[model samples]
Target: MKVAMIGAGYVGLVSGACFSEFGHQVVCVDVDERKIRMLEQGEIPIFEPGLEKLVADNVAAGRLSFTRDLTGAVADAEAVFIAVGTPSRRGGGEADLSYVYQAARDIAGATEGEKVVVTKSTVPVGTGAEVRRILAETNPGATFHVVSNPEFLREGAAIEDFMRPNRVVCGVESKHAEQVMRELYRPLFLNETPMVFTSLESSEMIKYAANCFLATKITFINEVADLCERVGADVQAVARGIGLDRRIGNLFLHPGPGFGGSCFPKDIRALAATAESAGAPLRIVETVNDINESRKKAMAAKIIDAMGGDVAGKTIAVLGVTFKPNTDDMRESPSLDIVPALQQAGATVRATDPEGVREAKELLTDVVWCEDAYTAMEGADAVAILTEWNHFRALDKGRMKKLLKQPLMIDLRNIYPVDEMEKAGFRYVSVGRRAVGN
Candidate 1:
């Protein structure tokens, strides 16, 4: 199979590489000449775990390639994947489909024969229909099938998710399109992966619904964590007790600053806009968005309150700036809100992340960026763990105690145990739980 992935951002680059790994001849197309050049030299522009090695291996084997020539890539490909971004539009919260539509126009112009045009980007319901209409209008005689194939790859674990997806959902109108999709995903068939065949609208809805539901679960648990704090209960034990239930099956139940990444925040907002436009608003989703924003903002206050009702003239050590660990994505990270709020409140902040420093430098300012967590903590009044990076899980308590001016700690991700932190001679504050050594 020959696959051409358009818009070589995170989704395009990862999907194109993974397709090549599956023994398909893949060419990734992007408008950015520098990014394509970087890929040619095996210098991945994005920081995804194992992605560079995967691309390097496939390129070495001559199965994968990158190019700025979209027409050349599409003319020889069996499947053209539109994996461009669909960010939330400013002021409206609706998904901006301009990029997707432009990609469709480009693909339509470049497409030669019968091609399976798969939308690997997350789009709203009826987007596939719109894309198909655009393609037909651009090239009236062109024969192509627009299939909705939304990606469900988690940022940090995208490679693992793509290689071993639980199920592959594809929306196709014709049997011929279905067969092409099956052939494209033939590797997953060997593992008996469930391939869901549904209507284009349903396939589009599935992606938004899945992301919004997960966002709701995170918001629910975060609210529960707040209740646990007020009632003097342990949220971790509470999460475990409910997670053990077979029906509930614990995931996204951990209480944290809030759900913040490339997907949830934008998807939920888009979903709400979609619902309202259709005359059936999803009030729960709207509330989830509101509550999650409040949660992120509230975390700054939590840190300030922990530091003797004031952070004025305080130096706080912030561990982890990325939205999550194992990836250097700082999109919609809680640190984006917390760090700025702390600075506004007159606190001098020092931060460190294993992978997020470079990207964080672009988004965050006026903070002392350090090489490691302990270095960031040195001379700080308190230390706050925003993202649960693995290195932060096993920090030397004595060293942490010696580093900070005050033996205060805020575990926003709840990575550290209260009893253990208490035993280490530090006052610890965490989400949805009672403070230790108060």
Candidate 2:
């Protein structure tokens, strides 16, 4: 199988590499020449666990390649995948599908013979129809079958998710496209991965629905964490109790600042807007979006309150700044909200992340970026663990106490036990746990 992956961004790079690893020849096409150059030079532009090795192994085996020549890549490929970004529209929740549409037009011009054009980007319900329309309008005589095949890869664990996905969903109306898809994912058949075949619209809906539902679960738990705090209850125990139920199963039940990433924030808003446009609004999803935003914003104030209400002349140490661990992605991260708010309260933020410093340096400004968590903790009034990175999971309590100006700690991710911190003789604050342990 020969695959031309359009857009060598996160999705395209990972998917193309994985497909090539499955013994298929893959050429990742990107409009960005620098990105192509980087890939060719074996300098992975993004930080994903095992992705660098996977791409390198496949490229060494002559199974994977990268190019900015879209036409050359698309013309020789049997399956052309559109994996471009569809960001939320400005001042509106609708997805701006201009990139997806432009890719469709480009694919239409470059496609030779009968080609299966699969959309690997997360898009709206009627997007495939529009893509089909674009293909026909752009090249009236061309034969193109547009298939909606949205990706379900998690950021930090994208490679694992791609290689060992629970299921593969494809929106294929034509037999030829279905056959091509089946052959493309033939490697997964060995593992008996469920292949969901649905209509184009259903496939598109599935992606949004899945993301929004997970976002809802996060929001629900966050709200419960708030309630647990007010009612003198421990949210960790609460989460564990409910997570044992088969229905809940506890994935996104961890209470934190809020949900922020490439997918959740935009996907939920886009779904809400799409549903409203279709004359059936999703109130729960809409509320989830609103609540998550508020949750992220509220975390800064919580930190300030934990630090004795006035951080006007204080220096606060932020342990992690990325959205999650194992990835350097800073898009919509809770630190974006909390850091700025803390600065507004006249506090100096000393932050450190094992992998996020490079990207965070670009998004965050005027903060004192440090080499490590201990460096950030040095001379700070209080320390806050915003993202639960593994490095922050275990630290010397006595060393932390010695480094910090005071023994004040805020564990937003609930990474520490209240009793242990209390016994350690430090003033500890955590989410939905006992208040201000000493």
Candidate 3:
């Protein structure tokens, strides 16, 4: 199968590479000539686990390629995937579908024969029909089918998720389009990954619904963490107790600063807008967005309170700036909100991350970037763990205690047990758990 993937961003690059790895010929198209040039030289523009090696291997085998020529790529492809970004529009919570529409117009002009145009980006309901209308208007005699195939890959684990997804949801209007999609995903079919065939609107709604539900789960746990703090309970044990139930599996149940990444925040807001436009507002989703924002501000206050009130003129060490561990992506990270708030309260922030510093430098200012966690803690009044990276899990507690000017440890991710931090002779504060030491 020949696949032309439009937009070469995170979704396009990962999906194109994975498709090539499955023995399909894939050309990843991007508007940025610089990015395409970088890929041609075996260089990846973004940081993703195992993506670099996979892309390099596929390119070496001549199964994958990159190009800036969108027309040339689409003209010879069996499936043209519109994987462009639909960023949230300013002042309105709706997803801006300008990129998706532009791609459809270009593909309609370039396509020669029957082609499957797949919407691989997370979009609102009826977006596929809009694409269909755009193509029909652009090319009066063109024969093409618009299919909805929303991506479900998470950052840091995108490659694994793409290669071994639990199921693949595809929306097609015709049996011919369905057969092509099934054959294209034959590798996953062999692996027994179920494929759900549904209407275009249902597939579009599925992506937003999944992301919003996950965001709600994280928010619910965060609120529970706050209650746990007031009632002197442990959120970790609470999460475990409920997670053990067969019906309620634990995945995004960990309490943290809040849910912040490329997907959840924007998708939830867009879904709310979609609901409102249709005369049915999503009240719970609207509340989830409000509560999540408050959670981030509240976390900053918790850190200040742990420092014996007033962080004025204090040097605070922050660990992990990325939304989560294992990826360098800093999009909508909770640290973006918390760090600025700390600075506003007159605290000089020092931060360190394994890979996020490069991107973090753009969003965060007036912070000293350190070589390691201990370096970040050196001479700081308090240390706060914002992201639970693997390196942070087994830190030398005694060494950290010795390095910090004040032995105040705020484990926002609950990386350490209260008894352990207390035994190490440090005052500990964590989310949804009893505070240890005075």
| lDDT: worst 10-residue window of model 1 | 107-116
Q: How close to the true structure is residue 1 of candidate 2, measured as C-alpha lDDT?
A: 91
lDDT (tens digit, per residue) of candidate 3 on 114-183 = 8899999999998999999999899978898889999999999999999999899999999988998998
TM-score of 2: 0.99
Q: Please, what are the lDDT tens digits per residue for candidate 2 over residues 14-46?
A: 999999999999999998988999999999999
Q: What are the RMSDs of all candidates, in order?
A: 0.8, 0.9, 0.8
Clashing pairs in 1: 225-432
> Per-residue CA lDDT of candidate 1, range 153-235, in tens?
99989999999998899999889899999998899988899999999999999999999999998999999999999998898
What is residue 135's positional error in candidate 2, in angstroms? 0.5
Question: What lDDT would each prediction earn against the true structure?
Answer: 0.93, 0.93, 0.93
